[model samples]
Target: MKTAGGDAAAKRRAGERAAEEVEDGTVVGLGTGSTAAYAIEAIGDAVADGLEIRAIPTSFQSRQLALEVGIPLTTLDAVDRVDLAIDGADQVVDDPDATAHGTLIKGGGAAHSREKLVDAAADRFVVVADPSKLTARLDRSVPLEVLPDARTVAADRARVLGGEPTLRAAERKDGPVVTDNGNLVLDCDFGAIESPADLARDLSAIPGVLEHGLFVGLADATYVGTDDGVEIRAY
Candidate 1:
């Protein structure tokens, strides 16, 4: 495992490498989380250096960060298509045959509902992360956004899929963590996932599942920051 400072530095390097894809007069998709926050800052700096770009943010947190960095903001509804999306992943598995972006487990920050939307809307989606985030297989719990009223139904479905579902709770506030879309998040632990695409389809078919963290066929490429240098993996 990398030290805290090493992880931060790696994340910044990955973010900077991804930011190199941005160009003037492009519609970019800004993602959420700590790794993506570094990308947001880099994009902000790019804007300061006179890169004319409009961004659609995946979360409120990203929106604020983009504003602080001086990147112009836009809504998805106002754009025809996003040129590119640079985001981060919780876990990335190198499975070229599995999906276009390989297999990614995201939503650690609880913004996956919108993250999925923005990722799919882009012409190209790039994931930026440090080496610590890569895994031989996805073993982390997949996050599913559920409607408030459909929590029980979602949990039951998760159980049927061999997952132990737990409602994510707020750290500061009481009760469940609510998404920006006014939904609850269920962290479903299925141990090591074998087929991420099949599981993603199954979870999507479930009623009241706003979105799940299994990002299939969305990643065009991934930039992994390493001690030696940045590693670019294309799918």
Candidate 2:
């Protein structure tokens, strides 16, 4: 654990280290969010230093950042596989017996749906975060992308699964926040998520659910920034 400033520094360190995995001529999956911004910046720097790699960005924000940083960009339509994906997690659980088992609660930036797509397409998914993001039990809210017409049904399903789902409101504009895919996001909080994998499956079964934030068994590794240093955990 660290102060707010220390946490930011740790995030930068984790991002920097994760970028080391990017090799020349590899197609990378770029993730969104503040922590992932660091990875994008590092990748951009690598490109300046002569690294030859193409990238698939998970969100508009990530895509814009990649362009600004000078990383060559591509689209999922143009590429079938990603060699690596570096992303951030709202919450990360390390224990195998735990409900999540490498599960994550993302979408703070409303990009989890796209992030999940890119992550799943990658051969390796690496999560980079400050130590504080790690937890024994996931207590953060799960973000679910739902079809506009099925918003009510999604909320109903969430309640049945023991969660309190709320439609996320946009801070800068009127009405609810809309995802890049033009869907609504339901931020569901099921206290202490005793079985994240089960909940994930249940969420996916819903007809209107496009994607949920629970990333069960997808992370190949994590780089956690700590007061001591960066800790590498490979699953």
Candidate 3:
């Protein structure tokens, strides 16, 4: 088993590598999550060194981090295009047939709805992950941000699609975890997903589901951190 420190180091490796992709005078989409945090810090360091760029953060967490690191922020509405996006995944699996590195399961932070928007808008989306996130198949629970009033109905619909939906409860709070968008999250488990695209479609079709965690055909590349070093995979 990998220690927390080792995992953190690996995450830093991948994240910093992904940050290197950013260029001057570009609008970057900053992603959320622990791994992505490192990328944000790396970009901040670059900015301090005179790498001129603007950023559109995917979540409140990312926005705060960017501010702390002195990275200039912008709104999506103000930008015509995002040059690149760097993000992390809960799980990533290789798909030989796809143009990207593979499929990704995200939203462990309950920020998938916004993350998807920024990632999709970017000219290129790069995923950063540690070895632990890599898998032969995406079996991790898929996070779905649902409208608060439609949580129960969305759960029912998710079950009809063959998933076991569970409301994500808060760790310290009393009720369920609320997303930044004022939505609830349903973590739907589908064992081992055979076709991620089909499941994504079905999940999206469900009413009140703002977004699901299956990121299909969005990643342009992946940087995986391993014990030896960082491995770069391009699609």
**TM-score (all chains, Cα) for each model:** 0.95, 0.95, 0.95
Per-residue lDDT tens digits for candidate 1, residues 121-202, read 9999999999888877889999999999999999999999999999999999989999999899999999988888889999
Global local distance difference test of model 3: 0.91
Candidate 3 wrong stretches, greater than 4 Å: 1-6, 95-101
Better of 2 and 3 by lDDT: 3
Name the lDDT value of residue 205 in candidate 1.
94
List model 3 lDDT by residue over 126-145, tens digit each.
99999888777889999999
- For 104-196, candidate 2 gives per-residue lDDT tens digits of 888888899999989998999999998888888888899999999999999998999899999999999999999999999999999998888
Best by lDDT: 3
Candidate 2, residue 42: how far the Cα is off, in Å? 0.5
Q: In model 1, how large is the Cα lDDT of residue 93?
A: 87
